[model samples]
Target: MNEMEIVADRGAWRAGFEERVLAGYRAAGCSEPLARALLERAAKGIDDWTVATDGTEWTAVGVTQENGAAVGRIHDLTAPQGRAWAERWCAGQGAQRVEVRLTGGAGAFADYPVRGQNRMRAAAERPELPPGLTVRRLTEEEYPGWYAGEEAAYIADIVRAGALTPEQAKEKSDHDFALHLPQGYLTPGHAFYAMEADGQVIGTGWVNHGFLPGVTFGFSLEVYEEHRGKGYGRAAMAVGEWATRRGGDEVMMFNVFGGNEVAMGLYDSTGFAVLDEFRFMEL
Candidate 1:
């Protein structure tokens, strides 16, 4: 078997890779806006990419090849050609792990030599409220602090689980959570919210306008670890959904890792149905 050649053409591949991955996401039933925003993150250099012989785009941290296959590290891949290309990459590169994000029908193809398969769960409908909690929009002044708290909680969870070292977690957490800012909040079609108790924030969530049209996406929900299983996550989700519905969109969508059973249950109990599943593979 010939070693498949893998090349990184960041300049030429960047835009097309973003578009194709996002397009593949939409084809797999993801909302247009959510797909676009996810792609936008890739475009902003937050992700990387490589092109294959069939014109399929593969987004990842890097790429290589071995044993007639082309291998790459990726966040997601939805196109059939893209998936096949990845398989070839894996075979050729002797990749031990290939993190892939797959959606819809592509999930069934996991038999192609990956270590394990995980589902990416999503909620595309409005969320329901539990009791004794209220949901409200979060203002800009409040988001930064809220985001920081959320980041800390996330880091704490990962550290405890040994999924991330403290230094690695710190580096990953240093983001301007406000980058999406008012767009995820103040826009007439978007809403960001935080759950509060006696003037102190407990959890946070938000819905952004459709990345395209006629569809909306949700993000940024986080609850302090101490507050886990207490219904704060659900309340925050409900608040985001209510805002999306109020903005005139009928559907509200959000994604979760399949292995995150706690979160999957939270969304499931709040009226969110599983519309699609994606897998993350790392090479």
Candidate 2:
């Protein structure tokens, strides 16, 4: 097959790009509003979009910089030689540390070892909570302190991932944080829980509905530093899943950042399977 030509054309690329993103979000069980919000944020860099095409077929991709390194998003890429074209195209943009990301794992990009995010799912199982452990609503008095720490840690992680500058990460994190907790701890569709073991608070987690028709979104799970490695994380997850099932959701799903082996191991051991992934490769 002849090599495809890569050219800039945001107008032609925008529709397909939106379609691909929406489809991926749908598969990951995101609510329509949240998916649209995410799509809007994603379109911010469309000025850098390029189309790789022959006369009969095409794919759209956008490249942008993250912490001085090049990052590319390829949308519904199906052309045989599209990967080669994307590599050269990114390099031409003066990228030494180049990476190409896609919404889902396509065989065409199998060489992409890094996963940016994983949408994983498991059947809701009503496991017995570890002895002497209980999950309870996060009281209003505790919400503020909990969220402050959570947001700080999240911003730090984003910075460490080299996916955004500290300022950008904080802004993005706050925007998303507000979207989920518009009413703070009293948010209508969300449930924030504090995990207690032997009458002592040991961890926290949250879950929400409406992200998908009947799937519950497990939002956050954290075990305090002093509580790490004591199996509280797994126990917290089990309670979360049980709560999800009790709320009428048959499946519980959540997203995990790639390379977070500790979290991944916890989820995998607790019966979760990767339903979809945002795959990438650094060139």
Candidate 3:
């Protein structure tokens, strides 16, 4: 892992760094499209990234200030030298603590809690509905419900995960505000739906088909606060699984924070198996 360089802010910079990161991600079992998506999604304007090589082979791809600290996605975590380089890189960034994120939860099936993230999956079948429960495409008239529900769900999850205080969540909520929910609000690669029971709205779910076949990535679901604990979350996932299956997918995969026991229970009871468990260490 020697000869590592700051490549950031350098001319012809794109070739070496992005390639190494992309290569490392691919070598780590990520599909090419998924690898590119991960790179495209690294924090915008992050000017600190590091790289290591064995001549032509990319040994590591490191970034600083991701969600606020430095970390590396090494191609070979087993190599002592690569891990050593990661330590040096994070320290160079003045990181009080560094966290190495293993996407897709490589930890659940393996050793230690260090890799504790669950990449869950369930085969698509017409999920059984609770008595009187159903789902439909969210109508334009449901904008108010959608807006309120999404905000509450987003804030609740972050707050519960200790990622934000209530006030902070509120402030970040409007980072992408929609003063009004437009009719037919469709985003490519995403679909939103409303869950119903006895013809009344119970919850909202947002879903997307991600790379790696047969997997519908996640359901950003929120049941009205008063309506939770009555099986809406599970029903929402069932509906989501069905939707993905209808669209020709065989498996529906998703992740919830390790601390989200309620959500974890819903998935586990609904037959999703833990494929990975992720753990983060503040180094």
Each candidate's number of clashing pairs is: 19, 0, 10
lDDT value for candidate 2?
0.71
Please give the CA lDDT of all the candidate structures: 0.54, 0.71, 0.57
Better of 1 and 3 by TM-score: 3
List candidate 1 stretches off by more than 4 Å.
1-71, 74-97, 105-131, 139-144, 156-166, 175-179, 182-191, 196-202, 223-233, 257-259, 269-283
Model 1, range 1-283, lDDT digits (tens) per residue? Answer: 2222355554555566566667666765656775675566544534444444334443243454422334455544434455656655655556644544444444634643322222223334655665666667777888667666766765664454333357765654553344545343355655667676656667777566653454457755677566777757766766665666666666666656344667766776766655444343444
Poorly placed runs, candidate 3 (over 4 Å):
1-61, 66-76, 80-85, 103-118, 163-184, 209-214, 275-279
Query: Model 2, poorest ten-residue lDDT window?
Result: 96-105
Worst 10 residues of 3 by lDDT: 107-116
lDDT of 3: 0.57
In model 2, which residue pairs have backbone atoms overlapping below 3 Å? Answer: none
TM-score of each: 0.55, 0.74, 0.63
Ranking by lDDT: 2, 3, 1
